[model samples]
Structures are given as structure tokens and as C-alpha cells.
Target chain A: MLFDVQGTATDFFTTVTSDAVRIDLGRNPGLNWDDFVNRWRVAYFAAVAATPTPAGTWTSVHSIYRRTLDALLDEAGVEYPDTDREELTLAWQRLIPWPDTVQGLRRLGVRYTLATLSNADVSAVVNLSKRGGLQWDAIFTAEMVGAFKPDPATYSTAARYLGLPHSEIMMVASHKYDIRAAAALGFQTAFVARPLEFGPAAEADTEYDDAFDLNASDFLDLADQLDA
Target chain B: MLFDVQGTATDFFTTVTSDAVRIDLGRNPGLNWDDFVNRWRVAYFAAVAATPTPAGTWTSVHSIYRRTLDALLDEAGVEYPDTDREELTLAWQRLIPWPDTVQGLRRLGVRYTLATLSNADVSAVVNLSKRGGLQWDAIFTAEMVGAFKPDPATYSTAARYLGLPHSEIMMVASHKYDIRAAAALGFQTAFVARPLEFGPAAEADTEYDDAFDLNASDFLDLADQLDA
Candidate 1:
């Protein structure tokens, strides 16, 4: 099984926002970090969207976050210390796991080979998995594949390395677009819903679709459905 | 830390030899299967040695083993069944780990990130690690790097993916050639002494080389020296 790490397994939103609030809130009480973090996530999404898959130079997701954060801070006129900026960028490497992430992974790991197929840089994925106490059969990243997720090359590259056909492998993610891309390439898709991925105020798409091979509310539910 | 999985952490010679004896001894009581397995290992080394590190079409270690086995059986006029040959080839993927492997990995894991840097296919490494109940922070293989061990590209590619400099990484291996290549690239080298690597009848090198950063009798010794 290939897992999408960002929103599916780890709570990057809460982790990054908490780090931001802890580091900067005392100095700027009026600054709404929730909105700032939302903007940061949106900027990251845009940066990745603009970058093409392979055939040219590849920009790492780490660089994109660092670069975009600088641009965002400049626009907001927030003259943060250079150290703080670096620390916040490093925060992406140690995102907190969702409540059921560890337990579910432990359960599913017994019957299935679990691996990370993330758009994050290989280092970031390794650090995140290690920090979260997650044991993966192997760690794969866009950096290794030379393309981010949603690219056919990314999914195909993972399948090739695994010595498994796309039809036999399952792609698990909380995002519909990721599963949709995998499905297009003949991979079995499991859509795991993370209701607070974008925070409590935002409405997440927790809908079940027959189009996907499996649908569940969280990773534990995913494990139960898979009978792992 | 990067590790050579075959002889350093696992006893491939014993595992393969035992599997061969179990499957073929009854059929051919006159066959010296131990010598045959040794010859098989030597052929594997020669095959990888002939292949270029990069710029050529890369062949996986698994493919090399399978091909060489067929050639060996043909040369020996063994007339082995195709199914038996396939099963023998699969033996390399589930080699038994050294007695100190899993426990030492568990201990060192608390203080450092542990990963495999072996000349095995990604799937083989994954299967071996999972089956052995060995938890690595990451599983890296020659297939992922496009080169076998002793090639500078193999070590450098791992460093590139890890976002770590060569000086900070330690290459642990029973084979001198592997650690030598890693050391040439500025990586710290740890020579692990596996006295019975070739079997009880063979004299294996268990020497202490000052050229390497450290030398240990086993994984547990290495862990203790590293204070992990």
C-alpha cells in the first residue's frame, strides 16, 4: 500500500500553525495566524501546481515552502528573524501524526507493506515518518521519482520500484485529486476522509464515492475496512 | 547511518545454502551444494563488477541473480525444474539476519536514523526487512541509486536523497570494498567483522583497520560504541 503523507496521515495544519503561534503569538497578538497559515498552504499548492513533472529541472517541496514563505512574509511586512523562518520551514519535516495514524499503520503493517508516496522531499518524508514513530517498509518521495503526486510518472515510478502492477497496488489518500490521478493509472484507490485537515471552520469533502475502491473516515477505519 | 545488508546485517550464505540443501539434497545426494552456493555468490559479484555504475541501462541485482542461476544450472548439467530455480532465486530476498541485527537495530534506532545501503533490488530489500522484523528509518537499494555498492554513485545518491553530507553519514559493512568506496567519498566508515560470513570452514577477515573510522565485532558492539 502507498500512502499520501500530508493530510492523510499527518496533521501538518495543526503542527505548523501551532509552531507559528508558539514562536510569534507573544509579539503579535493581533496577527491571525490561522488565516496566515491557510494562505501559506494555498501558496504551497500553487507553487507545486506551477511546476511540471520531470523533463527539466525539479524544484524540491522544501525549497518551494521556504521560497513561498519568504514571499508571503514580505507581502505581510512581517520581519521575522532568519532563524525563525528556517525553523518554520523545518517544521514541515516533523508534522504531527493524526490521532489514529500510528495505531492504524501498526495494524495494517501486519498484513500489508506500507510505504510513503509523498510529494515531500525524501529527507522530509524520512524525518516525518521517524518523528511520528511510523515504521514503513520503504520511504519514497517525489524527489526520488523526479515528479510530485498527481503526475503519472510519480505513481508509475513507485509501482516499478515495488515490482508490482498498478492494478495490484492500492493508493490511500485523504484528497480526492490524488486518488483520482492514481485511479487513472489503474491503481486501486482508498479515499480516507480527514474532516479537520484544513481546520475546524472549513468544510472538508468527506463524501463516499463508489468510484473509489474503498472509503473511510480515518486511518483506523481504513484498517478495519481492509480487515488488517 | 547507511548499512550493507547482505553480509553485514544478514547471513545470506547460510540461508541460501540451507534452502538449497533442503530442496535438492534428497534428489542429488552426491551434489556439493555448499560449493555450488559459493560459486553462485561469486558469479553475482562478477556480474555486478562488469556492469557500469551509470549512463548504461541498469540491471537490477535480482535480475542478475536469476540470470546467473540459470547459467550455473546449465553449466552444471543439473537439469533443475524451472519452478525450483525460481524458488532458489527468491531465497536471496529472505536471507536470515545475523543474531545481533534486529536487536542492535532496535537499540541504535533510539539515537540515530538507520537505513539500508545495499546492492539489492528495492522489493527484495523491503521484503527482507519486513520479514526479518527489522525496522529501518528508510530502505535504500542499488536499484533506487542505479548502481551497485563499491560504485561512488551508490553512496552519493543516498546522501543526495537524505539531504545529508558525506561527513555526517556512516557506512557500515562487512565488506572492505563497500566501506572503502564510501570512505573515499568522505563518509565515515564502520567495518563490521563477520567471521563466519563465508561459513565455518572458511577463514573470513575479522581484522581491525585503522583506515576505517571504527570497527566492531557485531551490531551490538557497534551500538554500544555509538552509545545508542
Candidate 2:
């Protein structure tokens, strides 16, 4: 089974926001950290949307994160040193897993080969997996494929590396778009619901969808339902 | 650290020979199994040497094993069924690991990311790793890179995936040719001595080369010296 790490396995939103709170450089307690974090994520989404064509030169997720962070900090009037920005951006690599993530993955790993097929850069994913104590049979990334998720080449590249047909490999992610794209390409799809991926106050779309091969509330639920 | 899996981590010679012994369809006891195994290894080497250009059509190691087995059996005047040939060819994916491999890799993993940079097919390496209890942060192989080891692209592809410079990532292998090739490309080289890689009766090379960045008797010794 191949997993998408950012939201499905680990809570990047909480982790990055907490780091912003801890390293409050120019922020007053009156400042709404949640709103600021939400804006930062919005900017990230916009940046990804504006990414160059897959055939263009490679731009790492680390570089995108750094650029997005600089733009967000400037807009928030939060002055920060260059070194602080680098550390804060790197928080993505050290995000903590959800309560059920590790155990669920361990159980599933006993029955199936577990791997990470993430948009995160390969080095970042490697660090994240090691930090989160996740054991993957293999780790694949957009950097290796030279294209981000939802790109046909990205899914096809992973299928090629795993030496499996698209029909045989399962793509598990919290995002519907990711699952939809994989499904269109004949890959098996599992939709994992991470209700608070944006934040605690945000209303997440956690409803089950019939289009997905499997809809799960979390990793544990998914593993149990799969009889792993 | 990137590792060479076939000989450095697992004893493929013993594994394949034992599999042959178990499925003795047309074997004569007087026929030396060690000699037959060495011939198989030589055929594998020739097959790799004769591999088509990286950009050519994909050729899996498993397919190469079956082809070579057919030729070897024919030469030895041994008749085997197609089913038996397929089963024996898959023994490459179920090789046993060296005694110190697992522990040494575990210790080193605490400090540095561990990955495989093998000539084997990616799926085969993944299966071998899972079966042998080898814990790797990432799995890379010739199939992923579209070229075998000693190919400049193979080493460069691994460095690209790791998002590290050639100098920062170390290439650990038992084969001198692999080390020399990687060293020329500026990768840190570690020569791990596996005395019985060919077989118990074969005089395998285990010399410590001063040219290499580090040379040790085994994975554990290499780990100890690296202070990982």
C-alpha cells in the first residue's frame, strides 16, 4: 500500500502552526495565530497551483515552503531572521503523526508492503519518516518523479518503480483530488478523512464518498476494515 | 548511506544454491553445487554487462535470471519444468542476510539515513529487504534509475533522489568495481569485506583498500568505525 504522508499520516497543520507560535518573532498575543496559519496554507496552495508544467525545471517543496513562508511573514508584518525562517520551514520535516497513525501502519505493514508516495521532497520525507518512527518498504516522491501529485506521470512513475500495474497498487490519501486522479488512471483508491487537517476550527469534509474504493475515518479504521 | 544488497547485505550464493538443492529435479550429487552456483553468478554478471542501454526497453532482473537458468540447465544436460524454473529464479528475492547486517544497519540508521542502491529490480530488493529484516529509510534500484551500478547515471540518480551532493552520501559495497565507479563520481566510498560472497570454497577478495574512505570486515565493523 502506498500512502500520502502530509495529512493522511501526520498532522502538518498543527505541527507548523505550533512552530509559528513557539517562534513568535514579532507577534503579539492579540494576533490570531490560527488565521495567520490559515493564510500561510492558502498561499501554499496558490503556489502549488501556479507550479510550472511538469516538463519544466524542478523546484523543490523546500524551496516553495521557504518562498511561501517569506511572503506570509512579510504580509503579517512579522520580522524574522533568515536562519529562523529556514528552521521554521523545516518543521514540515519533523511533523508529528496522529495517535492512530503509527499503530495502524505497523499492523498494515505486517500484511502488505508499506511505502510513501508523497509530494514532499525525498529528503524531507525520509527525515519525516525517521522522525515519526514510520517503517516504509520504500519511499517515493515528486522530486524523484519530477512532478507533483495529480500529475499522471507522478502516479505512473510510482507504479513503474514498484514494478506493479496501476490496478494492483493502492493510492491512499486524505485529499479527494489525489484519490480521484489516481482512480482515473486505474489505480485503486482509498480516501482517508483527516477532519482537522486545516485546523481545529476549520470544518473539514469528512463524509464518506461512494466513488472511492474505500473511505476511512483514519488509518486505524482503514486498517481494520481492510482486515490487516 | 547507500548499500549494495546482493552480496553486502544478503548471501545470495547460499540462498540460490540451497534452493537448487531443495528442487533437485535433475541434479547429480557428484556435480559440485558450488561450481554450479558460481557459474550462475558468472552468467548474471555477463547478463548485466550485456544489458541494453538505459533508455532502451526495460528488462527485469527476474527475467534475466530465468533466461540464464535455462541456458545453464541446458548446458548441464538437466531438464527442468517451466514451473520449477520460475520458483528457483525467485530465490533471488528470498536471500538470507548476513549475521551483522541487520544490527549494524539499525545502529547506523539512528545517525544516518539508510537506503539500498542495488542493481536488482526494485520489487526484488523490496522483497529481499522485508524477508531479511533489513530496515531502510528508502529503497532504490537499477530499475528505478534505468541503469545498473557502475553506470554514472545510476549513482547520480541516487544522489538526486536523496537530495544530497555526491560527496555527502556514501556508497557502501563489497565489489571494488562498484566502489571505484562511485568514487570517480565523487561519492564517499566504503568497502565492506564479505569473504564468502562467491561461496565457502571461493577465495573472495576481502582486502582493506587504502584508496577507499573506509574499509572494514563487515557491516558492523564499518558501523563501529563510522561511529554511527
Best by lDDT: 1
Q: Candidate 2 clashing pairs?
A: none
Where in model 2 is the C-alpha error above 4 Å? A26-31, A53-56, B26-31
**Candidate number achieving the greatest DockQ relative to the actual structure:** 1
Give the worst 10-residue stretch by lDDT in candidate 2 chain B: B25-34
| Tens digit per residue, CA lDDT, model 1, B125-226 | 889989998889998888876777787988998998888999999999999989999999999999999998888877788999999999999999999999
lDDT of 1 by residue, A1-228 (tens): 999998899998899989998878577776777778778988999999898764436688988999999998888888889998999999899899999999999999999999999999889989988889987899988887777888898999899888899999999999999999999999999999999988887777889999999999888999999999
Poorest lDDT segment (10 consecutive residues) of candidate 2 chain A: A48-57
lDDT for each residue of candidate 2 in A164-203, tens digit (9 for 90 to 100): 8999999999988888899999999999999998898987
Candidate lDDT scores, in order, read 0.90, 0.88
- What DockQ does candidate 1 have relative to the true complex? 0.87
Q: Which sections of candidate 1 miss by over 4 Å?
A: A53-56, B53-56
Collision pairs in model 1: none
Per-model tally of clashing residue pairs:
0, 0
